[model samples]
Target: MAPQVDITVFPGNIVNNEFAATTTTRHAINPSTGEALPEVPVSTKDDVDVAVAHARTAFKTWSKVPFAERARLLLAFANAIEENREQLERLLVLEQGKPLGLAKMEFDMGIQWLRTFATMEVKDEVLDDNEDRIITQTFPPLGVCCGIVPWNWPVLLGLGKIGPALITGNTIIIKPSPFTPYCDLKLGEIGMKIFPEGVLQVLSGGDDLGPMLTEHPGIDKISFTGSSDTGKLVMQSCSKTLKRVTLELGGNDPAIICEDADFSVTVPKVATMAFLNSGQICMLVKRVYVHESIYDKFRDAIVEFTKTVVKTGDGFEDGVLVGPLQNSMQYEKVKDMYADIKHQGYKMALEGHAMTNSKGFFITPSIIDNPPEDSRIVVEEPFGPVIPLLKWSDEDDVIERANSLKMGLGASVWSKDLDRADRMARELSAGSVWINSHFDVAPNVPFGGHKWSGIGSEWGMTGLKGYCNSRSIWKWKKVM
Candidate 1:
């Protein structure tokens, strides 16, 4: 039986293994109905200072604890999350505007990530082992980490940063997006039962809290996941203190469908990536490039598939695969893009459904058919359920166009010929490239971005290294 956790109960900041209330509070809106849910506490500068001081104090012992013991505690934390999975899933759907099914997937993946990070160990590298002298290198954890998690996939991304930082012996204070902070706060509450006081904490606030944490001297490192523009600001802020930073920013990813691609299989896969989670994912496929030879067939097939298969409504309603945009700001931005699409006289191949006189920030999925390469929908990432399908007659030209963007987070190629697909995938300048698949991510893979996409890695060994400092030790065996 599921735990009787109240899905409607709003939580405050988790600092020093306790719930800390704030003088100011804000209401979290339900994206499904545009109704206010409950009051979420907004942390102040004092809260940050207190949290940081506690973390610094806790780091003294947490960093010295045996790695095996840390692993055991992390596993216990994962188990606690599993026990309250149903409550977390419902909270995620209500706050993040994703289907309950996707929320469950996110929670499951988050648990798996914690387990994976627990098993990983950073061993010392021996450079020399001579009789006269010995040389070795080791990784020491940074003092205190600040993980700034975005609203999209809050559970997975939050754990992505928290797992590596904690496993590598660094204490972290998570600042969840105000748009979706309930589940993360609850996560912090759950973690407090397993981890030591101040080892893992969460602070909930609005725009002001982010700058306070990022610019705070107490924070040794900042792992930020957000838009490219905001990432630039974060990098600039961290530069002032020379703090280590790992940024996983925005992406305008492209998917190239080769002439020999299997239309039946490729079309649905591409559509899923383009429309899933209402296309709010940073690494989602925002642009589709189809060879001119079969562009028409691929376009028509995707349109028909989206119309028949994709459902849009409240997440609680049965068969609703797509929910409203997580917030009103994003809803207005996508609406502006829609207006621009009309002004530019672009043809929409499949406008799934018209916008209704609804209360929530809802938008029906739409596909732009063969928009110009430089068009807004093609060049800029909508970050919504709108995708642009373009025609490409030449492989070289298509690859060039795909690589032209400054944001190279993830890309995919679809082709029956393994050699052809592999060759094309190699040419795309993205952190994660897939052939005949899209959005295939794992906890063990080192996922980051190229160019303006991001600065550091998030998962795998590279991600763990991001939270630590390298030190070389030279020992003299004989007295000199």
Candidate 2:
């Protein structure tokens, strides 16, 4: 028999601050070991109605609570999450299959973000003031928000929606990815005790659940993180109800290495950035363009570093630099991509094949050397641990190639020459361009995409606004 695991987090969905059981439920599998972990409730269309109706009712009262008190409760929830860090971290690693360090960091980041929003003050702006008249701008909450969290970073992504939505007075219902729903459901369990009934909710199920929530007339908005294809569908679903939508979608990000970059500093940093989370991050460096003058040196340096840096295994084990792929759907996708690369006779910097021994979804971190620019691995997002290194001599040529995709999520420019890197970063067709660094996000900074990656923004004042509607207030005194 498989070793027993905890299942206390479920039995039913929480509605009106209490457990409401659904007859059906589903079990989660440990991505690293392929073992059944726990059975969680599979909520349904009726559950969506109950959740949204409760949220709509709660929003009436929640919107009236003092902003400062709301912030206090949010911070208190953050504290609660930290206090339960050990349990949350274990589930995160079990379902998500990221290393412990990464799992811990993601949870920590979520806590930190809640606190950041706690301090943020979105005060009413006084547009004009005089004896005869006064004008002010206020942002009122959007009611009944549904945050659809992706599997890759469920804790962080789920909290990314929770913190802002609640702090800004919008009640939230989170739909976590089926493959990684444990932590999110647990977070909902935590929220139930701390927040007023219906203020925060989590519903865990497969494909059909999303459409039900999105199409519900009671839902006011949706904040989603997933593939560009699904994002388009989310937009279509919400369109019928005219619900507001904020989407953070796919990325085929690029990293430009100018001739001036330091090989020692650049190689290892880029290697980590490229393969972190097994290259599942939407912002992870996908396509790399190196100046021909330093291309060979850069490629060799990266290969040496990759050998020393990566060791795939279970997240709980010691000395494991990377963990297994999060689920079988993504596992098969990466498997097919790797097979194609082999069949096409691409050169692998790290000689290996897809992993099979551990009963887990695992793949070796791979880098292709000088593949044709038109290759599938070069053009499509493998969304796994494979990347391509291409050479370019002309600045104009490389920039054009990088911007060729319909997606413009993120890009990076690396050079010891500050001016050249800045110029290159400016021209790169991406929403967030980093000069030397990659994937660093702050709560106070606005982050999103340009073309196909996202709609609207998250974080900063703009992020807070995304959850609200701007209402202009006017007061005038009669002159007698």
Give the poorly placed runs of model 1, Cα more than 4 Å off: 1-5, 352-354
Q: Summarize candidate 1's per-residue lDDT along 253-291 as a digit string, tens digits.
A: 999999999987898889888888988999988999999
TM-score of each: 0.98, 0.96
What clash count does candidate 2 reach?
A: 0
lDDT of the structure predicted as candidate 1:
0.90
* Worst 10 contiguous positions by lDDT, candidate 2: 1-10
What does candidate 2 score in Cα RMSD to the true structure?
3.0
Estimate the lDDT of model 2: 0.87
State residue 407's C-alpha deviation in candidate 1, in Å: 0.6
Best by lDDT: 1
Q: Using TM-score as the measure, which candidate wins?
A: 1
Measured by C-alpha RMSD in angstroms, how accurate is candidate 1?
1.4
